[model samples]
Target: MRSLIRILTTVKELRWYYWGIIICSLLTAGTALLTPFIIKEATDEVVASLQGRGGGLSVVIWLAVALLLADLANTIISNVGGYLGDVMAARLRTRLSQLYFHKLLTLPQRYYDTALTGTVISRLNRSITETTQFLQSASNNFFPMLLTLVASLAITAWYSPWISLMLLVVFPTYMWLTTLTSKKWQKLEGEKNTHVDIAGGRFAEVIGQIRVVKSFVQEKRELASFSRHFDATVGLTRTQSRYWHSMDAARRGAMNLIFFGIHALIFVRTIQGVFTVGVMVLLIQLVNLAKQPATMMSYLVDTAQRAIAGSKDYFEVMAEAQEREGLADPVVGARKQLAPGQPMIEFREATFGYEDGDNVVRGVSFDIAQGERVAFVGESGGGKTTLVSLLLGLYQLRSGQVRVAGHDITETPAELLRGSVGVVFQDASLFSGTVRENIAYANPDATDEQIERAAREANAHDFIMGFEHGYDTLIGERGLKLSGGQKQRIAVARAMLKDAPILVLDEATSALDSKSERLVQQGLDRLMQGRTSVIIAHRLSTIASVDRIVTLRDGKVDEIGTPEELAQTGGIYAELLALQSGSKRDRKKLKDFDITA
Candidate 1:
């Protein structure tokens, strides 16, 4: 396939290994050819004259020794080829993993929003694994089998032209049958893989929402649905396996027919004195050599399909439209932030969307002074998240630009932008590692004192030290062992350690109880000192202290002013505030008489 060819071209760097393994494999085939000659000579020359000739015994002994040496040589060659194949496989796998990792990091954020998490994980894990497996076989087994077939046919023709011609007749037929079957199976395999992906996606979704399922008491229904989907996947795999096994069986039967017919013709010729016994014996070896290539037809066909599939998947990942970086035509730095003064951020008429004509944030404009604190507020589906995403340079603007300090985000190098911005999402995630490692992730080289200071600034130090292992305590996957508030605090600590001048907090306090929220707010106040902060929150009270408030509607700015100014205007913001205030009052009144008593 075109995809397969592209993947093969990408691996041109491994050509040396390919050649090395090819040489060893061909040498092994040569040893196999020598096998027939040794057998034929031992039979006719040694056994026939043993009753009379004195030199017969010694000839027989040398011939036997030669056979042993040839077999040993073949074994050594095959082993060497296998070693080379394995080494090449390991190298390719490492390169692939690194490529996928880098690709995932560099792709635009919209890609993540659209693709399923499990599908990506499976592609990176199983898809690449399948490709590597096929590569190993292609080098070690497939090439050797082809060489054996060619060498055996040439040698057969030298001994008996008629038999060689017959083999040639069967070879093309065998190849045709194998190729047709492989093509069919290749199509089936693609379908099977799709079903597998669906099953994986469903399984992952269920695991992720286990809490909801439990709350709804829908365990029985969930289990039944999962079983049905899993069974469907199994059915597809079973069909593929049956087809593959049947193809192999048919190929084997065809091979046996050709093998027997060749031997019969050769034996009949020997009876008519047209061939010597020694040559007849040699013919037998030649016939087997001829069959060696055809016998491996099924395996080769399967390997080819796997290689094609693997390459297709590899290129699918590669074919993703990569994010383009700004050119270096004009040497002027578009944005600069590392100066000794305050760092300011400005969005000049910025507009953006994941796709064309679907603007999620249109004509947005804002400016944060050196150390000003601003908060974004709106109802669900507002552009608060999109705006924050743009500020972090995860998504490029359709029109206008964002400047960090004084540099345009697009023109600033990716690494430089990442180093300058720190963000903590509403749902905090941490990798499986020690508490200390998670806190110090942003500043890996930070000393213990520095790490503790950052944690204190995020109000995470007290609870972390209370653990049995203190900073050494391990957090499970995604920091599942830690509570929501704990995770947020650790995330804040990480951001603090980075010491970036710009911070974006997305509902960072939503997960905390009142007591924890108060403690974290104190630490946040400390961290926000002298830095530009962008806060996104549903609870307007949380952003009451900010210098300015920006309310979004649909995908555009609906209002921008101080909290007091927005409330006095009796607009959308005022109505929402009054509704929340009245709801809170009613809840308090439900228990008001108890305080008087």
Candidate 2:
């Protein structure tokens, strides 16, 4: 019962389109049960009268027409019910997909990091497909079956109350058996879903690293691993199929036994003259009508249970906690929230982590004045990235505060903060779109002239125009068609177009050749002319241009000073610069390939 309520709740969220069909199906079931009476009348009045030489031909014709019309009514109602099922499935799919996409926009970054991509995709694809079909069937098919059961019982009572009561016993007994069988099937389905998810995740992982597998001669290994999961999926599915057929055959046999018993009973009663031939035929037809609903009842229980489980998963995603919002009565925009001419960013004893794991950034405090260019230099896993993430409102602080542009990031709306900051990472991600579209992504309202200007400033326009499609060519998935340097240049152009008050670069030029790096450095200098910039780089020469350097170790700031001042101190920053430059000789010995080539 609770499951039914949950399934209905999901259905109710969609606008009612097939609900009329449900009403029509019930009406048709009632109309169909009336068919037996017409058949009985035709048998007694039409055929019997012709042999007896008493009644007129008109009685026979009228009974024949009545039976014909009952059949026609059944056909029309069944067609309506089928049409409604299609419409309901269509609407349910659209609404559920929309809800899923909307929920994705609010999920925390940590959720995405920990959850497999294929698991999320399977839930939206396969799970939603099953759920929508089940919902449509429950409304259009299940309701009609229930109505048929009621109408069949009523008609049977009119013929023989004792026989009707005996027939009614089949309904509850089959229902109980169906419920038990369906419960077992639901467990198998859950197991089947788990294996299916594993298979999808494995496939996605293999495809993402196909080049690596081939390079390492591990294709056979990957195939063998994939085959193992595929076998598990098939094994579970075949087990489910066998169980389904066995239960189906058993239940069908039971129904047939009741059907034959009713027929034998009617035959004996007719022989004893307890009922007329027409009355016996009517009871037989009624018994057959009862079977239709009884069989459907079993299927309805199975579908209902599957849909119930699917609905629970659907709502679980919908009910995920959303990102927090600011107070209702609050400061308006970024400018209004921040004090006039104060520092653009400040971290006051802030601490944070991805989850319950060890804190990645702890007790970090710093302030960046307006228009100041600051650089963070630290070893890998030294919390440099975590601090930038917190400043961008990607993760909330556990204690203390991180203020951006004078407004607390945790208390401020993320949408507003995102607009005020432009960021470029080491990966330099680009969507599958034209050069112009990718550059203008941060500011969709950018004019063609503004796009060209930004591209020129980022030193990407010359190479972009070299292509046959110029700015119009598709970049393929994640800009795979372009060279690494070309992708990074486009990313730089994107940051330039946003023209935000703050710019962030996390090894943005590390992928470029020396010449290209020089060009990108010039562009970065121009983009950061007046904006406050925070950069993270391994090349000590590149970050040396920033006004101040901040060095971190083990989630704590160990030192901060001007580039020359830090270099003079022989502190952590000086040691890093020495270590990075010492590797320059080895780096130069490597081949110089232009990432844009």
Candidate 3:
């Protein structure tokens, strides 16, 4: 209930619309209440005329017209209320979606490390949708129902306190019955949501990686797993539905018994001459009007439960700690000036790891002067990428500090730090968009001339022009329409456009054929000019020209020197160099150092 109220309050800007809905609902209820009185007057006139002591047919005709106008008014007003409700609901959805998306953007990278993409998407869609629907329904149905119940009871009590008392009895009784089942129903709904989210997550995963699944011939296995999750939801639904309906049946039965007694009392009193036939008719109609809310109670409860469950999920994500970087104002196109003799980039005793895992990088320290090209080379899982991630401030270090441009990254905003660095990874990570858009992603404000210049520098211009649409050509998701080399070149073009002071290339050429590697490396070499460059490479040949090489072993720096110096040190770099050279003497020497080739 608190979550539901919080969601409602989130759209306070739409309060005027809410007020309009309430006013319209009250008017609709007013028209409905007027009908019974109007009909009663008409009936009483007819009765008096039959007894030859009435005003005439004129009175009845006027009353009938008034009733018609009232019905018409009710229809118009109720439709207006529904319109307001719908507009408010849509706007609320827009606001809530924006908030959720903003929260997602601000969340630390660590949160995403364990969260599945599909699950995250599923929760956002389901929770916001459910919340919007409930709010709309409350504005449209719940408000009007409450208005009708209150007005009906007031008029009824004026006519007969006993009948009003009986009508009031149904509300608390029905609510109590609903309350009994609500917690249980919500529990079951939450359980079902877990299965649904998992299924949805898997569904998206399978679709995204369909090629891999097909290659492995695991389509049946994936489908079975998806079906099993939904099947569990079905079983939960069966139990939940049975429980809810059984309780609804009991509540409805109770309502019927109470209304049955009320009807009998009205008939008895009219027959006893304690009330006129017209009065009896009015009382019966009011009782029926009061019964509408009772009938809708079960549906309202169901919607409320779903909304509550979804709101809990929504708020859970919102409650997560957002990145401190997100709190700072964006520092766009504003590079912090470095002092003289300061390293362009520095890592001092930096130690870091993923959530609750052994440290991937420990006590690692390094410094890079401006315009120096350095490379990190080691076996896989040597913390080469981790070191770069720390430098980028993607994850907070467990200890020590990383500084860029002489500013401690812990104190500086990540946006400001990242704005100074350009990165190109092994995978291109292109979006499904135009050739122009992918390159401009690094710098959204880059002009067509600038974009083309970057592409030309990356050697992607000729191939891009080969497409019928040229720069405007739509790349499929993750640039699937392009070859591996094409994607890598486009990624290079993106980083080139960034034109940051620092550049990091993580195995950027490792995934390419020799010809492709040569093209990408040429582009990379041009991109690295006059920048502090950090290269992570598995292919030793690529780093032969770097000013220095840092070799990592077990998350610690084993050696740091120029390529020539490291080639003679007989360390990890030397061992790798020797293995790549395929020299039998170096291989025999590696055994003396207890190193496996």
Candidate 4:
């Protein structure tokens, strides 16, 4: 009930539409109530004419015309109310969708670290859709039903208070019955949603990585897993449906017994001349009108449960802590200039970790002077990427500070800090779009000439022009149509187009062949010309040209020196270099340090 109320309150901007819907619904209920009264008047007049006490055929004809007009009015009013309901529902959906999407954008990066793409998408679609549908149903039905119940009872009481009292008893009886099942039904719904989210999350993951699944021959395994989740939902549905229908049957049985007793009393009253025939007709019609709400009680409860469950999910996500960077904050056109003589990037005693994990980067302090080039050389899981993530402000440090442009990152807006740095990850991470769109992703306003210049600098111009459409050529998702090297070059071009003050190349060339690596390395060299660059590479050869190297071991800095200096330290970097050499003596020496290639 609270979730339903919250859903309505969240959309207070649409109050005018809600008012329109309410007015139309009340008008609809008023017209429906007028119906039984019209019929009673016509019947009474016809009986008077039969007894020769009526004004004549003309009086009956006019009453018949009154009935026709009332029915016509009811038809028009009902349609108008329905149209208003539809408009209100659509507007509500639009408002809710905007809210959910905006929340997704503002949520912290950490929320997405463990969240699956499909699960997130599924939750947004399912929760909002369910909430909107229920709101629409309630708006169109709930008001009118309540009005009918109240008005019908009032009129029935004027004729026979005993019948009115009987009609009133049905409400609490039905409500008590529905309330009994709501909690259990909601519990089952929550469990089912978990399974569905997992299934949907896995489905999206498999589709996104179909190549891996196909290569590993795990299609059957994935299909079986997907089927298992849905199958579990079916089992739950079987139990839920059985329980709900059984309870519904019992409620309906009780309603029948009450209505039977009410009708029996009405007949006895009329037969005893305690009420006239016209009064009896009106009373019976009112009783049936009151029954409508009672009959609809079960359906309303079911829909309300679905909406409540969905709204809980929606609000849970909305409640997540958003990053300091507001979605509306402009990342571009708001770059903070570096203070003179300040390091372009600085990590001062920085410490960080993933959720529920030990620190991945601990007490790591480093500085890169303006226009200086540096590289981090370490094995996998050595905290190299974790450090870069911290530099980008993707995760908050557990202790200490990372400064960008002489401003502590924690004190600065994340947008301002990230806006000054450009990154090209190993995966390229291109969206499905035209080549030109991909290059100008960061700076959408980049001109054709500027885009071409960046592409050329990244060594991607010739290959892109080789396509039939040149820069306008379509690249499939993540640029799947392009080779590994081609994707890497485009990623570099995108970073180049941003033209930020700092650049981080994270294993950018580690996935390419020798020929492609050399071509891409040439572009990297050109891109790094005068920027403060940070490179993370597993292969030691790529960072040899860097002015200094920072080698990490177990999340702490093990060595910091020029390539020549680090080569003789017999540290992690030297041991890696030795393993790369593949000589018998170098291999034997690596064993002394407990290092493995």
State, as a TM-score between 0 and 1, how close model 3 is to the true structure. Answer: 0.95
| Deviation in Å, model 3, residue 352 alpha carbon | 1.5
Residues 166-242 of candidate 3 have per-residue lDDT tens digits of 99999999999999999899999999999989988888888999999999999999999999999999999999999
Candidate 1 residue lDDT tens string, 68-106: 999999999999999999998898888777888788877
Ranking of all predicted structures according to TM-score, beginning with the best and ending with the worst: 3, 4, 2, 1
List clashing residue pairs in candidate 2.
none
Q: How much does candidate 4 score in TM-score?
A: 0.94
Alpha-carbon TM-score of each model against the true structure: 0.89, 0.90, 0.95, 0.94
Query: Which parts of model 2 are misplaced by more than 4 Å?
Result: 1-4, 11-15, 53-55, 238-250, 326-337, 580-597
- Please give the CA lDDT of all the candidate structures: 0.77, 0.77, 0.88, 0.85
* Angstrom error at residue 73, model 3: 1.5
lDDT of 1 at 245: 81
Error of 3 at 430 (Å): 0.6
Candidate 2, 1-597: lDDT as tens digits? 465455456668544555577678777887777787888877777556667853778887777788788888888887787787777778778877887887878776766777688777777776677777776776666767667777878877876787787787787667666766777788887887777777787778778777788999998887888788778878887887788778877777787787777778889988999988788888887787777777776566666666766666667777877676655323223444456678888989988877789888889998898789999877678888888888887877898898777677777777777778889898988998888899999989999999999999988999999999999989987899998778888998999998888889888887778887888888788888888899987576777678998888788987889999999788777665555456766444222211111
**Deviation of model 1 at 471, angstroms:** 0.6
lDDT score for residue 420 of model 4: 81
Tens-place lDDT per residue, model 4, 345-376, is 78889988888789989899988888888988
TM-score of 2: 0.90
Residue 428 in model 3: lDDT: 94
